[model samples]
Target: MQIKPKFGVDQLLFGMKQTDVKSIYGNPNKQFKDEDQNVIYVYNQQKMRLTFYEDEDFRLGYIIASDPELTLFNNTILGRKATEVQKELEQHSFKTWEKEDFDLAENHFNEDHWLILQSEYDQIVKVEIGAIIKNQDEFDWKFGAK
Candidate 1:
């Protein structure tokens, strides 16, 4: 019950609005508007998926997860053993990368934040967190850039 790995929780960072993400994760069992209209929010009991745009006043911006009880910044959870969470995200300095035919693994704490891991026989089913938007056509209409 300690899932505070980042990408909006303790001060709700990335652009912030939507009533400060509904005062921190409330009322979103589901919501929609995509096709470039943005404004998506799903919570599947905290498995998470948030994306808001309406030209930034809708804020939030994106935070998708596959939740294995979701944890990241060093504690690295989400079903573990993707080489032990890529050696605890390279002992906390991050900078990892591996695609391995889509077994996937990534960690780029720059170019506007990142962390994704998806493995199969080696555990870690899925986990994704991306927040980049420096206006590449509004981040390709809210994350077709991913």
Candidate 2:
């Protein structure tokens, strides 16, 4: 999986309509509703979960990726040391944040790119990327363009 920061992930982009996504990936292998009642498309082969916000016309909004081959700025981040991940992201013009998200795991977030990494025992375990919606009417969005 290639993380495009606040921009998007791989070929899937923020503000993309559900129809577009379905056309590209076909129907999700599995579908479920989140607590907010938003629809999530799960791709088992990709080890990826894509979230489409209902209020945003079911456009792409969030992504949860567990692939260890996750890449960003040409760097494979997952399964790497936290220190190494931080350095890689920083070298690519990302801001750094190292903290714990609710005590579940250590978190490294890049506000500049809207990316979050969850780590256990100092190794990144998951990669989260979400978009920033500026205007729903225009579908103007970028992952971290706040």
Candidate 3:
């Protein structure tokens, strides 16, 4: 899987409805409404969890993946040390992360870019991302355009 911040991942673009994704990935292993009332689809075999928008549109807004081959900026990201990943993001000029330190998990989020990395055992374990939605209807691609 690929992480294209402020855009889409692979063929799955933000603003795509659940049905749009179903056409590509087929039936999910599990599906449910999240606490925030957004629809969620989990594909266990693919190690992915997709979350849609909360409002009526139900566009694809967020993605969480644990796939070992997941790459960001052409670099394989998962399983690397957190510092290494941070450096890579910095190299891309993505600074200003909202970092949270905890006993088990260290979280970093660049809200402006809507990219998140979570680390356990000092190693990056998961990548979560969302498009910069504008007017609740479109993916703001300006960030990636830079």
Give the higher-lDDT candidate: 2 or 3.
3
Candidate 1 matches the true fold with a TM-score of 0.33
Error of 1 at 83 (Å): 8.0
Higher-ranked by TM-score: 1 or 2? 2
Q: After superposition, how far is residue 71 of candidate 1 from its true place, in Å?
A: 14
Best by TM-score: 3
What lDDT would each prediction earn against the true structure? 0.59, 0.78, 0.82
lDDT of 2: 0.78
TM-scores of all models?
Answer: 0.33, 0.85, 0.87
Please give the distance, in angstroms, between residue 51's alpha carbon in candidate 2 and its true position after superposition.
Answer: 0.7
Q: Write the per-residue lDDT of candidate 2 for residues 4-38, one digit (tens) a residue.
A: 87667777888777777788778889999899888
Ranking by TM-score: 3, 2, 1
Tens-digit lDDT string for candidate 1 (46-124): 7777777777667775676675556666364666667666666666566546455533453323232455566666667
Candidate 2 Cα RMSD (Å) = 3.6
